[model samples]
Structures are given as C-alpha cells and as structure tokens.
Target: MLLPRGVPEAGRLAAFNALVRGDRATVCRAAEVPLLDQVDLLWANGWQPDDVLHHTRVALADAKQRRLVPDLVAADRAGRSTQAIDPRWQQQLDDAGLGDAQARRGWLARWSAREGLEGAQLVLAVLAVVETLRVPPLDFLLPPPGRPDQPLASAASAPDRADPVLVRVRRLLAKAESTEFEAEAATYTAKAQELITRHAIDAALLAANRGRNGEAPTMIRVRVDPPYADIKNVLLNVVAAATRCRVVVLGQVSMTAVMGTASDLAAVEALYTSLLVQGQHALAETARSAPPGARTRSASYRSAFWLAYADRLGERLREVTDHVVAGSTDSDRLLPALQSQADALDAWVTERFGTLGTSPVRGGWDAAGWTQGRLAGDTAKLATGDLRPTRRAIG
Candidate 1:
C-alpha cells in the first residue's frame, strides 16, 4: 500500500510488518498516513483488519496536539473496532507503573473528573487527551504524588468578590438600554458584522439580479434595519427574512410579468402568501409519506419544500413567458423587453444581493435553460438601443 511521501522508511516498514503480523499497532500506524493519502491507499489496496488496527495506533501516537484524538476515540466507542488496543497492550501500561488496578482507577477518576468523564468512557477520554495534550503520553502514567498533610484551599473559602471593571461597566451602561459589557459585546458585534459584510445585503442582491437576467422573471429585494443594534439577532433575522422574501418575490414576479405593468407586484405578493400556505400543506404531505424516525423533521422538510417551490417558480416563469408572447402587440418587442428586464434584474440582484454561488437561490437557473439565450439577447438590445438615440440626434 502507498504511504505518505515524507513518512520515514523505518516507520513504514514497521507498520507494514505489524500489519503482516496482524498486530493492532499496524492499524494505528496506518492512521498516521496523511488524510489525502490514507483514503487512496485504503481503497486501492483493500484495507485488511491488520492494516486498520496498525493505522489506528499510528494515528493515536501521531495525534499529539491535534483534535483528532477525541474524534478517533469517539469513533472507537461508536463500534469502529480499529481503535481497540490488544489486551496484552495493558501489560505494557503495567510495566510503565500504570499497571496497578488502584493506580489505573485513580488516574481514570482524576482524568474523568477534570474532563467530565465517566466509567468505561474514561478510556476514550484518556486516549483522546493523550493523543492531543502537549505533555508526553507517559506524564499521565506518572503523576506527582499528592501531599496529604497540606490540604489544598478551595474556592469556597474565598471572600465574596467581583472584578472592578465589570462593576464600573455595569453602572455606566445602566441607563443605556442598548449598551452591554463593552469588551464582550464588541467581540460578538465584530463577528456578526463580519458575517453580514461577507454575505452583505448588496451581495445577495447581485446574485438575484443574475438569476433574474438569466430567466427568472420575478425577484424581490428586501432590506431590513432592526430597531435595536442587537448584532446577534440582526444576522439571524436578516437571513431568515431574505429566505422568506426570495420565495415570495420569485413567486410573485412569475405571475405578474405577463401583465406588462407594475400592478402585478401587489398581485404577486398575494400569490406569494398563498404559495407559502400551499407550501405548508405540501410539507404535511411529505411528513405523512415518510416513515417515523426515518428522516429529520426540520432539515428534510425545509429542503423538500424549497425544492418544490423552486419547481413551481420555474413552471410559472415558462407560463408567464408563453402568455406574454401570445398577448403582445409586437412579438419581437416582447422578447427584447423581457430580455432587458432580465438583465437589469440580474445586475440589480448581483449588486444588491452579493456574490454568485454564495446563496442557494442563485444556482437553479442553469437547470432551467436560462444560461445563454436571454442574457445575450438582453445585452445586444441594450447596446443597440443606446446607440440608436445618439445616432438619431447626430443625423
């Protein structure tokens, strides 16, 4: 089996030999394989029980200072048998002065209490800490003996106290309903602003614009400014509002575009509300169809309903297009007008919404056949129209 490029030859040979011997160490050693190379070798060479066991040991040993130890231990507890050490491996612990049942129990108790562990769970907890802690694995095996004569003072013995800064800040902000603990509040605010700026309101608008230009006839842009500057709630409310708004806007536009007037915007809003109600019904239908505990409620329903809504939106766009074409004073004028609306909508959505591919609502157009024809047609018409006015004035 292939090993990582920089892995020492001796290590590889030892791991390979251990695997051949059907030793657990070999599986642990193999787990030390770099993430990218590990899967390739496992699939390519058909990993055997020995290979898996050796790799697990190597992974545990090499996991010094990484979070992988906890995950590895958890995987072992979850019936991933690769992480099991040989029963004889416990003898090695005894050799290291960790063999005494009382010593093992003491160590397990101390480790678990410190890390909130319990029972056989202590094994995985200890292994996880050993795999990740900066100290040597043997340090856990050899703890400094406690001094019984000088009992340690506990926090319960301390006098009632409070930090001066916290007291001062609380008094200063008492009258200010909007103010919070300055340092902690600032940290949370900064994080919230980062997400908002990164997935800015404008950025989402840009993507919506692109989708509109491509083929989606109806789109909505909703801007929300909360009454209070609660940054945490702002992010949650904005994202939720945007999701609901997109569904409403797209549904409305599809129904109204054929009317050739802005009056459809209001009509579309009503239709959007109706669709949402219909969506609720559809969700119930889906839940009834699924077996109990066979699926997650929120995730499965949200995804299913969104997919259903997207299909409905696409069908409406086609229906609107057909209706407009049949009812138009000029068939040629109708296509150009629709194309223009689409381009303007795309640019607006992208500029206002944010970047493409960032939002889920932005990607369904490719599947709907709106990628090429209408965008090209719209651009060509706009360019020609701009030139016509200038040329006529010159003549």
Candidate 2:
C-alpha cells in the first residue's frame, strides 16, 4: 500500500481500491514496517519529529493524512532509550504529544481506535502517512537521535521554562496577546521585549565569560501560514533583525530558516509568535471599524497593513534593543561577543543559502490601511523611558 514511485495515477488508485477491499488488518500490519522505516529515514536525513508533523499538516489535504504523521513519529520513537535521545529531540516529541508513546503499547491500533478509523480509512491513513514521509533529504540542522555523535544534552536548550525571567516574559506576552486595549497590549509587549533583550544579553555575557567563543550558529524553521504568508515573512524578518538573528524564507514550503545562537533563536521565535498574534488582532479590528466603502477588506489593504505594521514594529523593537544595549555596563566584553555572533551567523547564512534573491511580495498598495498599521505600530509603547532594566538590561 506504500505506493512506489513511477506508478501511474490510475494504477495507484486501482491498487488503493484493491487494498481497500482486502483484509484491513493485514494491510495495516504490512504497511507498518515501510511507514516506520520511512519515518526513521527522514529523521536520519535532517527531519525532526515536529518538522515532519508541520510539513505533513501543510502538504497533505486529508484530515486523516494530517493526523497520522505525529502518530507515526511516536511509533517510530517507541523503542529508543530515554538516555539516548537528545533533549531537544525529546522536547519536540513532547511538544508533538508523543512523550508517552513508548509507555503506550500497540499505539497504532490504539490511535486508530481513538480516531475512530476502520477498514478502508485505517488502510488509507497508513498509506497517506507513508507517502508523506518519503520526501527528499533536507539540510541537516541537528544531530538526529541514534547518531553516535548526537549531543543528548547541551547548554543550547531553551532557558529553563521555570526561570523567573522567562516565566515573567511569557506572562507579559500572554497579556499582550490577550488584551483588547491597544495601549494596554503595547505596554505589556514592550516590557516583554525588554525582558527578552535583557535575557539574551545575559546569556551572551555568560557564554562569553565561559569562553564559549567557538559556538557555531544553529538553525530552526518557523512556519509561515498562508493567505498573507509573504507579508508575514516580512514581519518575521523584522523580528529576526531586532532579535539579533537572520532568516532565509523558503516561500515554496511556507518555512523560514532562522540562524543564530540557541538563546537568540529562542527569543526570536517567542517574540515573533506573540507579535504575529497581536498584528492579526489589530488587522481584524481595523477591518471592523474601517470607514464604509474603504478597501479595508481587500487583499491589498490587508497586505499593506501588514507591511506597515512590520516596518513600524521593527523600528520600535530596534530602538528598544539599542537603548538597552547602550545602557549595558559591560559594553567592552558584551559588544565584542555580540559582534562575533553576528559575524559568524552571517557567514553561516551565506554558506548555507549561497546567493539568495529577494522574494517579491504580492498585493498592491493601500494608503489608508498603511496609515492605520503604522499608527497601530506606533501605539506599541516601547519608549526608551518606559522599558525597565532587568539589572541594567545587560550587566
């Protein structure tokens, strides 16, 4: 049922139908080996559990097809010893809700039952996951589990979730995302950015003092959802810039490869996610209050709004970062460390993407929407005076 390459569409459909008519249990059992093999192969070839799951959700059409990727990933990881798995790998598994996969025996059967699949549906779901997993190798970003050289744990892991600074940042951003009042949201967001900036600087200084100057850049892909993915890419770029990271957007796959030190990468992802939500909310609110007969509902207006928001928000964030950096007492050591990371990251991006070209964003200009977006961004309360120093912002 794992449709081999070069099979004609008619032949494939016919084969599918024939299998649908056969004993489902036997077909499922037979497909399991190839499916799990494909999953393992993908992991070895630079795909991680979350990466595969995200791609499957985007590339596949059927709900059953989308739902099976993570289950298959869980099944594939069931035999691994906990000690052998990289912490980041395990984090991805847990994020994908597969942390207990090993503890659950006969997961496939249980997943089928839980999802209410039967007979043809079960067979088709298995085959769909198999087909989805069999893609070309991607750029190897991390050491896959089972590799002899895999670093099972490292300082690169995200700051502990329980860290008071991170906990406070998350809290502030949550309020920023959830609040309806623009001023209130902006205040919360500014503080969050302040905290993130301070945390990153602290991490950088710590790394510098530890003489970890040889650390190479690492990468992570953040998904860009559709309708205005191109505009969203602009927002991502701006956030990446302000957060001291770099990005290469592969628009075809709706993914952007972000390169930086581990801590900066984490900061970028967290802040970008919060800002995306806040931008979308502001856009929707604009749509509702737009003067009658305005083009606020048009694609051009929405695109222009996002463009302006990204432009303005980026300016504010850079100002905040600059203000904090200027306030740091350890500029002698801190500046060099930051400069080295940036230089190393630039080289890494050039080597990885080699001579990239710009991606043209779609949609015509909308003056009114652009104005509103800029205003909305300006309201984000990131004034230098308003930002609090988490111990001189970077001591």
Local distance difference test, each candidate: 0.30, 0.76
**What pairs collide in candidate 2?**
none
Tens-place lDDT per residue, model 2, 39-125, is 778877777777787788887898866766667777777766553776777888877765235632466666676778867887777
Off by over 4 Å in 2: 7-18, 81-83, 98-125, 139-143, 151-165, 198-216, 251-253, 288-295, 326-337, 388-395
What is the per-residue lDDT of model 1 for residues 1-395, given as tens digits with 9 covering 90 to 100?
32323689998676545444543333334333332233223323322222223334333543321333323322222332333433323232334322112211122233234444333343333334333222211101111112122221111121112433223323222211132222222222222222222222233334445654222333322221122112212222222222222221212111111111122222233333333333334445546766776442444334433444434343433333343345444555445544564455445445533563323332222222222212211221111122232211111
Q: How many clashes (backbone N, Cα, C below 3 Å) per candidate?
A: 41, 0
Winning candidate number (TM-score): 2
- What TM-score does model 2 achieve against the real structure? 0.80
List where candidate 1 sits over 4 angstroms from the true fold.
1-264, 286-298, 347-357, 360-395
